[model samples]
Target: MSNPESFRELCRNELHSGPTSGLLSGYVQANLLILPQSAAESFEDLCFRNPVACPLLCKTNDSPYRLENHDRYIKNGHFDIRRDFPKYNIYHGGELIEQKNNCVDEWAEGHVGFLIGCSFSFEYALAQAGLAPKNVVQGSNVSMFVTTKYLDTSGIFHRCPYVVSMRPYKVNDIEQVRQITRLFKKTHGEPIDWGFDGAQRLGIRDLKQPEYGDPIDIAENEIPVFWACGVTPQLAVATVGQSIDGAVVGHTPGHMLVLDTTQVS
Candidate 1:
């Protein structure tokens, strides 16, 4: 990226080749979902019913993720969901079969984009409260796992197991994390479970082995805390094969969009 405007582009360049975490700071990271316009209304409605997993921050039209209106109000559907972010996945029958940097040429006429809320918001909030993510401090990505609990569903989209992200927390400061982060609706608010026992309840096999991101140091007496992840929906979108054969696009976890709107402080 040559300048600030090229931030998303730089993450794309790197993530297309490697992973994106701790690289794009202060940008509002997002979880992405792109589907045919035919399946969009149903999916959009699903997101509405389950806002936590599918916080529809924005949407764009069938075009490749883009924005043309400078002074007027804009629609996310207007942006091209394919190439706007770092990565794209082609899911066929609820299975992720392909991954790419962009899907402009691959996308057909009917497509819709969804930018979902991410953990970065709360992580940023945690850091502001002096809770440094061990992964971030160690220069690694977060560890994610699937739990036994299911997400509240809206038909067709059956109840799917929760996909959770774990970050290590010191035993001493768990309350501080709960106190400060509970108010933010944009991020996963507060802690659902604390300590390793909580992780075990979900049948998490390895406290150290994460399905995504890098593993970090878990100091003695430092318990791993889990939060409902945005990836939860992506997992559901994958498991329930009803709306499969469409281009699915998302931000590479950390390589988020730097939006013009700021939360009222």
Candidate 2:
């Protein structure tokens, strides 16, 4: 996990198929979304309005995937949106069509790719602070749920509710968790909410079940802390896709694209 190229090669060879929470520490891991040009503009606006849930890192057309800023693009090199990630969720007319190893075949004409900030960036920071994220410790995907909270709608993305990822921390360490996460605003920022009654506030009644990711144990002295998740956009795409005749593609929960940026370090 120390080498980016090696991790990519593992995914390239289909040897990996799980959430990438603690791997390749210090490098950025992005939540990837690919939309048709028709839906791209509106989705971009939605991200702008909901920065905590969908921080925009880079947006580019499919085919030649590169960051928009030319100088930075040169250093980051070219990434093929279709094959670089470990897993992808393919949607058609808003329905989840399939989960695939890669989306190289689905990058049809007019498709655009967006790279969004992910909480993984801050996991590295948390690790450095010795506040080990629960998912990393358990070797599981961060638990994610669709909440009653609504995202600002733009264009076809209508009535999309926010999705959140939760982690457990000792009650005493809650303040430290907030302070460490606050530094990575581009990556969902600080805890949106926390505590024994936290899930109820978001309309999630059962902690054992989540819309995405896996469940973990909550210690007696621990409380649940949440962050605006990148999964929020996928929930939006599902809701909006039913009404519109289009599709949205995204990385499967916990499976993300690793970047070369030292932004977290």
Candidate 3:
């Protein structure tokens, strides 16, 4: 994980894989979404409207055949959105068609790839603050839950419920954790809620059965803290994919794209 290019190469060849939670420390990571040009405007608007849930980093150029992070932001120009992530979810006609290690063969004209800010980008700062990100410490992906709360609908995307990533912290350290995360606004910023029954309020009934990622044990003195997730867009499209033709593409839960940019503050 010392070299971003080497890690990406492992992904490209399907050699190294998993939730990139703690790997490649001191670099920014992103959630990815790819859609047709016809659906780009609405999705972009959706991101702007729900900044906490979908902070946008960059979008691919008009050439849909390939989507790369903006070169200016990356130290190396060899990353490919389609093949760099550990896993990808493909949708069609409102249904999840399949998951793949690489989707380079699927890219076509009119497709636009989006790079969204991920809470993973702030985990390093959290760790430096002595508040170990539970998932990283546990060697598991951060647990994600689709909540009952709904995001503001924009254009063709409608009724998308908010998706949240959870981490447990000792009650006394929760406030300091929130302050550290708030400074990383471009990377999810702050905890939406924390404490006992907080997840229940967000409509999560069982903490053990998270919709995505692996679950961690909540210690006796720790509280479950929540953050807005970039996966919100996928949930939105799944609910109304018929309107957009059901051709959305994104990274599978917990498997994010690691980038060279370290800090945006």
Q: Per-prediction count of colliding residue pairs?
A: 13, 0, 0
Which pairs clash inside model 3? none
What are the lDDT figures for the candidates, one per model?
0.65, 0.81, 0.82
For residues 122-167, what per-residue lDDT tens digits would candidate 3 score against the true structure? 8888889888787888777788999998888888888889999889
The regions of model 1 sitting more than 4 angstroms off are 1-4, 9-20, 61-79, 252-255
Q: Judge candidate 1 at residue 227 and give its lDDT.
A: 77
Ten contiguous residues minimizing lDDT sum, candidate 1: 70-79
lDDT per residue as tens, model 2, 1-265: 6576567667766788677777777778888889888888899999989898988887774454555753342244345667678998989988888999888777878888888888888887898899988888777788888899888878877789989998989989999999999989789999889986877888888877878889878888888888899888887887888664566789997888877675741
In model 3, which regions exceed 4 Å deviation? Answer: 64-69
Give model 3's clash tally. Answer: 0
Superposed by TM-score, candidate 3 places the C-alpha of residue 184 at a distance from the truth, in angstroms, of 1.6
Considering every candidate listed, which one attains the maximal lDDT? 3
Task: State the weakest 10-residue window (summed lDDT) of model 3.
Answer: 64-73
By TM-score, how accurate is candidate 1?
Answer: 0.81
lDDT agreement of model 3 with the native: 0.82
Q: Candidate 1 or 3, higher TM-score?
A: 3
